[model samples]
Target chain A: MNNEHAEVMEMHMPTEKIVGQTDLYSIKSSTVRTPDAMPRPIRVKAREVNVFYGSKQALFDVSIDVPERAVTAFIGPSGCGKSTFLRCFNRMNDTIEGSKVTGRIELDGADIYDGSIDVVELRARIGMVFQKPNPFPKSIYENVAYGPRIHGLASAKGDLDRIVETSLQKAGLWNEVKDRLHEPGTGLSGGQQQRLCIARAIAVSPEVILMDEPCSALDPIATAKVEELIDELRENYTIVIVTHSMQQAARVSQRTAMFHLGYLVEEGPTDKMFTNPEEKRTQDYITGRFG
Target chain B: MNSLIVATLLLILIGFAYQVGWSRSRQVAPAGGRLHSRPNYHGARVAIWALVPALLILGLWAFFSDAASRAFVMAQLPSDVRAMGGSELAQALSRIEQIATGFGVVGEPAPYESAAGQALREFRNLAFALVVAAAAGTGALGLYLARRRIAPRLRARDEVERVVRYLLIACSVVAILTTIGIVASLLTEALRFFTFVSPIDFFFGTVWNPRFSTVGAGTGEYGLLPLLWGTVMIASIAMLVSLPIGLMTAVYLTQYARPNIRNAVKPVVEVLAGIPTIVYGFFALVTVGPFLAGIGDLVGLDIRATSALTAGIVMGIMIIPFISSLSDDIIRQVPRAMRDGSLGLGATQSETIRRVILPAALPGIVGAFLLAVSRAIGETMIVVLAAGNSPYLRLNPGEPVSTVTVTIVNQLTGDTDFASPQSLVAFALGLTLFLMTLILNVVALFIVRRYREQYE
Candidate 1:
């Protein structure tokens, strides 16, 4: 019975390229483009950013620029400081006790770590999704309304209701959950809960969204759905995702930065990085040779 | 023999049996075949077999030997003495028993008493000897059988495990049976109390006076309402004082305080629970009671030194650690991801705690509060000391009041006649208290279970 159900599910799914497929790295190496070819303005810029947890330095003098209206994927092995750097943009590292960040990280020309910058306001502008689907143990409607309610983005109850509806619709979870809006968010399936988290982040109308391996805990079908959502979100929100899966980075990100041992190995368009890379570490990491 | 000697002998025999079985199992192993269980399992199986039969025999002997000796003595007695009424027969048997044990009777005994005492002494020695021999014989037989069964294919380990499981079950049954025994005794005694005072009058009467009177005089009016009201009032005051303070303390410890500060302060706060309730009682009586009375005097309000207010405040102080520690643990149990989810949405730390963490932790906190209320309700020493023992139905916190626990203490202490309504009423009060706490615990468990379902 289970086998038949799985077959039916596979038939209904879109014919997306599976992981480890041969066609994944089929982008021609000859097609290289200069920086002038893509004229999107830089949304966030980092210069020699170093993060330290206690006395141990995690990210060492790493620098990268994220362009507007694009998905920038940070791809590396475990403990490569990709998630650490992702947290730096929204000043999440400040929440960690005894962990200090040095060097400048700017959001749209303003340094977020500056003394005048409010961490709470900066986080509202730059929302984050975590590695695991973590929804509040509240009703689905309450989960979506939490962000806008906290920020007072809605003037009235109707506005809050509208924001919740539009956010869930944007997350592509409104149809499956619209009838059960009063049910607990945690009661949903893992993939649905993840979409609820995305809707919660989107309810605040963030300009930028940072995702730290958002699909790592999901199955393949769920991963595809989230990747599709990331692609859809890129038209309005500047997206930065840290993923362990190189294929996921190649599929979802327009600009990909390769990190190795707390250093930026290479940064360029996804196709160029996958097909022809300037650094051997990037080549070795991408081709399943060595991490 | 005495139980200690029998126990020592049994231990020695078990050790010998274990050694014999271990060596026998090794000898019985086939030339090229492995044993199903190790030598240790065979040895354990033999030891348990040797111990159980002997222990059962010893237990049976300990249970019946005294009665057997008494029956033997009664059988030897002359018809005239045997036909004596209950008290006379009991006295004669005790005198003979004393004589047999070499504590001679005070006056010259009759000829029949002397002869019977001598016969009783001989019978006791024979009975003890017979019991010892039976126990030893059964133990040896069991050891031999167990050793003979220990072959290559024998499942000694499984047998030993089964025995051990039975032993554990027996231990748990002992605990459960003890609680059942206590409840049964309370029910019986409380029923006995109802014979003297009608249940309706005892439950609903407003007057609370129990006078010493003859069997049918009916002088006491054992009303439960006054004490119940006092208990409710005191517990409510305690809850009012402790709930907000304890909850806020938990929030600060879990959400606001630094790790080092939390670690240091948490144990110090918990030390409040470790303080003996009697010490708190003394503090309430000597310090807080007079202080409140002084304050009352300054405000031109009459407050007794020992009043519900004083006792409630002290009991609240005593229960703070219980609420705070339990609540701290519950609030901390809120998943870190939940906190991060709220904080990630640009919510401030306080906002995250107030909206997300607190709501998630609410059921558990409510469970903690209920448990604290039960603790406060059941508290004895503080109430006994500070709550003035005035069995009157009064609403004012400034006046003296008595609680169910305090009345139970009063009714049971100081040469109580157990058959009288004055004393048996304590059992009824205890049963009521037990039921109240039982209901509270069940409610707490229900809330906690519901909370667990949401998370896990």
Candidate 2:
């Protein structure tokens, strides 16, 4: 279902004509076993995705697949529509009043944008954390427990408590915040607040997590903790992260998708995508020829 | 007005003098390395040192002048006029001024008129001398203080910061004191009313008929239950009409409307608030009241044209802008990321608002609604004109009613003596209204605090 018309029409995608080869010295080719090969059965596949806000088309026909239980990173310049396409994955675009998405997005072989889908239930399965921490104006424990309570994950008070505790522990924030469980979530430092948000998203036990520049608002230390958390979360959940920092995408993601304007430039194993890209646009962007 | 002019004048003089002092000091020791504060800060410090004292002196003098000047003129008056008692003495001085100014006396000139005019002229001269001397002494003291530290090492910035801190504190203290004064006045008047009418009777009595006077003159029965009920009914109607519509308009502005439409429509709504309540009152009175009565006649239902419904509906219109404007700001303040976060989790627009946004902004929205409710209750002009001057308690929106503000206005109109129970009733009603609004304001403050603490 991936339409190639948009990829050719978008002028913002950087173009690099390949006149020389032999730069890809370390990319595992067909000659070698690509360490950590992509698993069988993709969990989410987005095809021919074109998005528009009124008359302004933001994303061209972008197509990509997210394999289960691995982190996929979308790397691009500002306003490249990488995040826009990522939002389409969970039907997050539906929240925008006038924003329209015309494409097929299937999650677990079910049409995500189908008329009969329950948006609330879909959201419960695909949670997200934002660039800046957005913990509810409640206690640290309550912040973690909010999603579980809303989704009815816990039936009793003890179950709710245990869920909250486990979520915090998974987010790597329980030890520091255990003493202040009843204290305000916002009273924590920036790094701690980001963890609180992760704990919040995981409380409902979502199968997939979308992060929109999750570490952009944080300091180096906080960014490292979030990156580490992303790596750990990949063991159980599929994660798609939109990042401006190329180094960060390289650090945490097993697969990398490069977008320019609205077009999906290139995507594959992280190492191969970075070292040698089939598309000229991907090469220029990765080699810093132009933004 | 004169004090403002004098403060401005002194401030200018001090500013110029400060510049001169700083420039002269620098000239005496040119290129004094690492001068304390920038040159402007140094100049401001000196200017403040001079102006602050002079302003204080002038303000204190202005406050006391009326009494002090009156004392001076009265003491200097001849013994004959002084002995004529309070009213006579006042009349004599006014007549003397008229004669002296060549307006001529109303009839033949009285014998004491010329002497009175001379005494007044002397009093004016004495006042002028005293004010000038006081101002000069203040300027001198300020100059002496400012001159002592015209050096680079002076902690001029720190000194200025201290002065600014005190100035801000003093301004807020004035606002606090004014509130205290209003509350105290309300409390004292309510206490006086309570002495005549028991609190229990005023609160619970079903019937309201006044039979008040002195015990022998004509003891009046004062019952507040009917008035309270009417006020609450009208307010409830107003809130019911305004709250939902206002909140929806807020949602449209924040969520649905385009930026251009929002910009255009927002000011139009704000203009509704700017149009005085009296104008809305008149619209309710001259237009809506008759319109309702006509509808009532056609429907075969007995409806008073000038009824609580008319006033309450118009009051609701008056408050729509208030609610919409505040709710718009609160909803907009709920953060774009929160919506994105919810949406990214696959929630639709309405679902995101209901589940995440509205809950997050609930305290702020409630705060806005409460503030509008208080505005509806305290409003006077709409009810005074639109609603009939009847205090009977009834639940029907179409029936005649009166609000606390309307009752106060009805009792305290012109030509009535202030000492009568009818007139004093206004103060008692005012006290009750004040307390109600005060409670509402405190609740709004507390709810708004939660909104502020959302991400503290």
Candidate 3:
């Protein structure tokens, strides 16, 4: 029912004015596509998106589509607005003062910026995992139960316990922490803490999960663990991950979006993006020529 | 006068030692040998050595000179004049010394006393000259030894650093020793007071009526319960006003207020701390008291002009800045990641603060509250002038009450008889107040440490 309303809203979306453009000579137009590759139905459509912090622009008119139930990776050098663009999906950028977002971004065909949409509900639907493991200073059980409790998802104590157990199992942390459910979440190791945060986010059963450099602070073993969890999660949830490691992007994502100097240079299937990118900048980034 | 000359001489010797040491180190460095320390350090080490021993001698001589002079003068006095008791002899000696210093005495001194006074002047002069000469000679010896010891192998820098370390340790010990001294003196006097009144009576008696009797009469009711109740009452009221307002102000400054507003307002709030509590005392006495009484009159309640409510409100206003500033720092110290995590979990700002930030900053806020309580308990001027010093046991905030601090002030201010229990009670009250605040601070520290362990 809400999907039809969102579809009509996206069709009636007003055109946004493009700000300062980057001087990349080999930048591809927004309509450019790979040959013999069919387009997937869009779950999130960002059209003519421009973001600014105070007077300085952080993201140019960069448009892309995030397909449902697939892992989409945003890869960029530092301060290239990849994280900024990811924050826009859940309106997390609204928390930053003097940050202005003027664009049309639709989630499940609904305009997320519409006045009728509540931010709390929007954030619950689109959860995020940060670079550093930031579990609440609470018991492991309470950490997983936080979201479900806030959203009133559980009708009773047994239902809440089951939800917590299931969320932890989905995050691959249940077995290690099952006996110590009452211990503080912070008492866990770094990798375990990060997995606990994932469980915390998925506890709400969000449709989309945003991972902002989720594995950047993890070791190789931990990164591998989170990557495997991400792959497993792709069967149920639409995932958007921002990564500094191109190899991890290729390993975990089905689609890869490249951002450079505040511009979305090229985006396509991970196989094509790593093998033969459409833009020179994307190719240079993949080949380690220059950030 | 002789001491001043000796000090000047010691300073000059130190300066000369520094120059000589610097030249010697420079001379050594230019030779085939490497200098072990900088020329400045070599100079400083020599200067310290030269000044310290001489200063020690001077300090010891200054401490004992008067007693030694009097002893010498007394020994030369006639046996009949020295036959008097210790106190009487000391009094006669002071009178004689005053006459010798050209301050006129009440009556003519006896022939023996006049002779002793002349002897005293001569002995004092001799003693002063000996002390100055010895101190100067020691400084000269130290200077020569330090200069001779300065060589390529001399660890001047290391020696100087060691001296500095000792100096810093000595300075820190000074504070600890002073606290020990204060506690010791209070303990002794309180023990003396307990001899006059039983500890059980003082602690358990409900009535607080100190009769102001003579030293041995021991005819006063020194009950602590009423004063303790009053202190707790006022402190509770102060906390009731300060905790919520201070915490909210801190939250606003940290989470909600703009940078410009925070910058403008934080110092203004802190300025309340700088205002003399006496001024707040006047405000409570003149303004708040009358205002409350006026309101009470309108409501047909009997509220005195100088009631506990008035003093507590003013004290609470005084402590708001303390709570606000400390809690602000503690709340601000909470990692931004904590807030981000809560916000990302779809919590509103208030919800995040209530559920996460406040819980994280709880121990620190509790510490701040305890600090405010201690301040409220120890506050003298505000309670002295504002709390009407009624000394009556009452639970009503509308009535005037007396706190321990106000009673201590009342006992010690004027016409005090130190030997009597009335004046002596002040020390006992001080000791009790100190112990109470100490326990409060310890509890606060314990909570704060436990809280810190959770986050860090």
Provide chain B's TM-score, model 2: 0.88
The candidate, 2 or 3, that scores higher on DockQ is: 3
The TM-score of candidate 3 is 0.91
Q: Look at candidate 3 and give me any clashing residue pairs.
A: none
Leading candidate by TM-score: 1
List the pairs of residues colliding in candidate 2.
Answer: A123-B345, B211-B219, B211-B220, B211-B221, B212-B220
DockQ of each: 0.63, 0.42, 0.50
In candidate 3, position A73 carries an lDDT of: 95
**lDDT per residue, candidate 3, B285-342, as tens digits?**
9999999999999999999999899989999999999999999999998888888877
Q: At residue B96, give the lDDT of candidate 1.
A: 96
| CAPRI class of candidate 2 | acceptable
Candidate 1: where are CA atoms >4 Å away?
A1-23, A26-37, B102-115, B213-216
Go through the candidates in order and give each one's C-alpha lDDT.
Answer: 0.89, 0.79, 0.86
True-contact fraction in model 1 equals: 0.71
True lDDT of residue A23, candidate 3: 21
**Cα RMSD, model 2:** 6.3
- Model 2: per-residue Cα lDDT over A206-232, one tens digit each: 999988899998999888888888888
lDDT of 3 by residue, A110-131 (tens): 8998899999998899999998
